[model samples]
Target: MGSEGIMKDVTKQGKATVLALGKAFPHQLVMQEYLVDGYFRDTNCDNPELKAKLARLCKTTTVKTRYVVMSEDILKKYPELAVEGTSTIKQRLEICNEAVTQMAIEASRACIKKWGGSLSGITHLVYVSSSEARLPGGDLYLAKGLGLSPETQRIMLYFAGCSGGVAGLRVAKDIAENNPGSRVLLATSETTIIGFKPPSLDRPYDLVGVALFGDGAGAIMIGSNPILETERPLFELHTAVQEFLPNTEKKIDGRLTEEGISFRLARELPQIIEDNVEGFCDKLMGVVGFQNKEYNKLFWAVHPGGPAILNHIEKRLDLLPDKLDASRRALMDYGNASSNTIVYVLEYMIEERLKNIKNDQEDHEWGLILAFGPGITFEGILARNLCA
Candidate 1:
């Protein structure tokens, strides 16, 4: 960690910048109305109460559609996946191993293509996923699939939930900053479709997870320096903070069962974000050399966990009306893909910047990407336009 003269403990290593970003989703599309009305009804396995409750819960997320590795039609066609306690952990793991790896490879290909270079130049790989394939390390599969050099440094980060997305980026930032001429490939894939409407689980959390979480993969490249040949807008890392709040461990829980991992999400999560977000923002802004008057200049690329969480963060941070637009819109379009969500938000930001630049409008300079997970893990990245 070098020093920009901000805070001594916060590492200041080589400057890291985002060269490109790309996302991929399964071919199957599940609409909210169908999932809430038809799919849940079919999978609830005669539980009318669960179906009604799920419909109400899905509405709250404000998510219209989500991509899934297995479609509702496929779920209905396959008894093992649709029925309760039918598929063994081994079977489910096999399914996700292929689905998640393929998704990751697809997204990684997009990122590499955007970077416009050979994978031989990639120095390191950062892989993030909630899906725990039966195999020990899926990083080798990704590297092999992408034709990366066998000597590419591999750092594996799997099963961190939604927060893992930001966590992977943190690893990439460190690797890029600490090593010159470094190229870190950050990728995340989630196969949440396996957990969709599992009847062995209890109420509320299971239904909420079923209704809200979606399936997809996303990837991006982080470099020690920007790709000078490309005109891609640069996102430079300025601050990275990870805070584990006390006494909030039970707020969000993910446990393993015979069927799959069940999610136990408490209703107090939005309140938790509201309660502690200001302090998080304070730390980030101070480290980034932001003054009170400069707050408006900051854009937020937030994890669209749900509409409620986004709303709470917006209100707590006192951000502009449209500050959280990208998060909300991404959720609306793609649902919450857990660790894959932050990339969706970042993709949105990049797309917006590209649009503005093409239209000759002003591009945003400062931004913060935030993700919350099981530990009440509050992850934030203070970033700015690299050219600025």
Candidate 2:
């Protein structure tokens, strides 16, 4: 199996820059055990049976818990939004939109400050998420709040699901590559709280979901050749590939139900990885002019969909258990934050990888980043580490 590069490997080093990156999460960390306990109390389900099932579901090679922005407490605090009759689904959606929008703006502002860039310099804004939905949504509101140029290109991408963080990177890379001297801000905030239903026969998993998911947001600043000159670089974009497997449609899906947005994850999701990931990696690596073995340092910033998915990938790729520690840690700490989860993993990677840097000149390390989503699609990037 020959490894190759899929897209144009932007080899001519145009100044490398990730001007800034910021992440935000709810204050409280929700434990899966606590969720199972709640489910047992709320639904009168068998505690022993439910606990055993939850233990299996919570088994991740790396993560154990996740942050929840709107717990039962947050909802209770915002009684106006969750009101009896007046607070329609539309109203509840508005509340979530407002909360996540503010989060994205704050994170973006922090990134700009850290990287020393002006909001005026930002020419494009990209927002990605699957957990929450709204119209004239977070990205547009964020641009306005920051007083960015009205002419700035605004992109609101949806339904990419968990893979959205890295997928947003790919989208921004294309925009930057085509527009000279352009700066873009990418923001992702995932909140599954609105989708948290009390219980229903249609969604037996809601109990697990209410326990597992948490709200989180991540922002990154990317710029073309000029800004890279002043910015501290983390990794340079080499090539990115988005691959969709044929006939594996039901692995993960987000659909609209009467209650709110519902998530359907097939029991066979692990098996889907078993059958497809190796070939997917083979094809992705082929696009980057490198074989798997030759790339000494690999950064697998995978979306922590759950414990089982991560474990399956680790086994399939024959990666060391520790290889996905950042991802597992993020999940244990934040749960599956849907689209924004990968950014947390990437943040941990950047923090750890940058610590050992000896110089700013030797930027030759190679890395791989992967994110999976509802389309049963995988978005991968082969990048060169620029931390030195």
Candidate 3:
């Protein structure tokens, strides 16, 4: 086949379309009010001023409540849970691994059911997380727990941080597009409770993650099959791009220390996004023959890294006031689940749009899903919703 002929064949096979999505959160609740007024206050008892400062910062995150794998009772008993380097931290990860894996299984089941109920049909599994930072990967556990075929191709992505969900989708798209008739199950989960380190006044940056991070898992079904096969709303993948900004390595850093994984969140993250987000968006829009045009006309599913991240992206992109409500709302409701967070935002977008179908005109609505991670990496997908 000539180049044009091959291109024609590829278009005929169609890109991967998101068939369904399911999300799960743990039962243990950690309300922001408790973290600010009680947990942190008690942990940082020696410094009332620092406690007060943390309380005020916690509220600014806009995360009201988050479900963690750790129980409040357990946390209370092990005050050192806030601080790592203990044998207790190792035991905590063992517990976290189980909980996070179960969450992934539950979410995957939901996605499978919504995608026509065929667990055996899943040919590939793309699991994303950064919670445990362990081995034997979550993908194998997920496959075994879900009773998938023995030959199922599995890929577990670790340490991708906040961009893991989009990373899963990008990989699933490639797998599905290359292997026609294959169904790709993408699962994203995290146990951020393990990342919560021992409280420290000296490393104020560590608290940025504690204040915003939470735990959750999300599953999305992507396949190369025709969109008409299922009634679920479809996000037909069009284009995706990943870019790492130059000289920005230190801006968003996460490192493991004696006190668990510590995050060094730059105060200027919002400014960085403001300065560079447009160029990234321009690259995506440019793919669909639009460059430097009106951005308000587009639908957005941005990763609300925190309240500041969302606000900065909105202002920088010159988007509508509510353009990032799903992202903001996810943060408010679920905190930042890291790699799993963006999928929750996408799930919210799917639920809201599916519930309020106004007209046939909206059968196809263009959207951009964006995520930010370490290395100052930007992940984006240009997609179109195929209404049920």
For all predictions, the C-alpha RMSD in Å is 5.0, 6.4, 4.5
Ranking by TM-score: 3, 1, 2
Better of 2 and 3 by TM-score: 3
lDDT of 3 by residue, 1-388 (tens): 1112222234467778888888888887888888866655445555676677777789788999888876667667676765435645475666678888999999999888887746666789999977765678888899999999889999988888888899889999999888866778999989876666555667666666778888889999887655453435468888989998999999888766544566777889888977888988888888877768568767888888888878888877777786787898899899989888877888778766766585433422778989988888899999887755
Q: Tens digits of per-residue lDDT for model 1 on 1-388?
A: 1112112233334578788788899998888987856665556565677667877887887999999887655555565766665645666677788888899999999988887756766889999987865555778888998888888999888678889999888889999888766678899999885465454335555777777888999998887655464425368887799998998888888876677777777888999889988888777887767765355678888998888898888777677887888898899999999888888888777777777778887667887888999898999899986532
In model 3, state the lDDT of residue 289: 73
Task: Provide the overall lDDT of each model, using Cα atoms, as 2-decimal numbers.
Answer: 0.79, 0.69, 0.79
Look at candidate 1 and tell me the lDDT of residue 306: 86
What's the distance in Å from true for residue 217, model 1? 0.5
Position 152, candidate 3: lDDT: 94
Give the lowest summed-lDDT range of ten residues in model 2. 1-10
Off by over 4 Å in 1: 1-13, 72-78, 199-201, 230-233, 292-294, 357-363
Give the per-residue lDDT digits (tens) of candidate 2, residues 1-388. 0011111234453633465688877666766656666645443445465566666555532345666666556556554433222334564576578777777777787777776766666778899866556677777888888788889999988768888888899998888777666777899887775675544444557556755677878888876554334567666777778988777677686676545576777888877875777777676667767675443346666777777788888887787666777788788777778778777887777766665464442223666778777678888887766654
Which stretches in model 2 have alpha-carbon errors above 4 Å? Answer: 1-17, 38-63, 72-74, 77-88, 200-202, 226-229, 292-297, 355-364
Q: For model 1, give the RMSD to the true fold.
A: 5.0
Measured by TM-score, how close is model 3 to the native structure? Answer: 0.91
lDDT of 1 at 201: 36
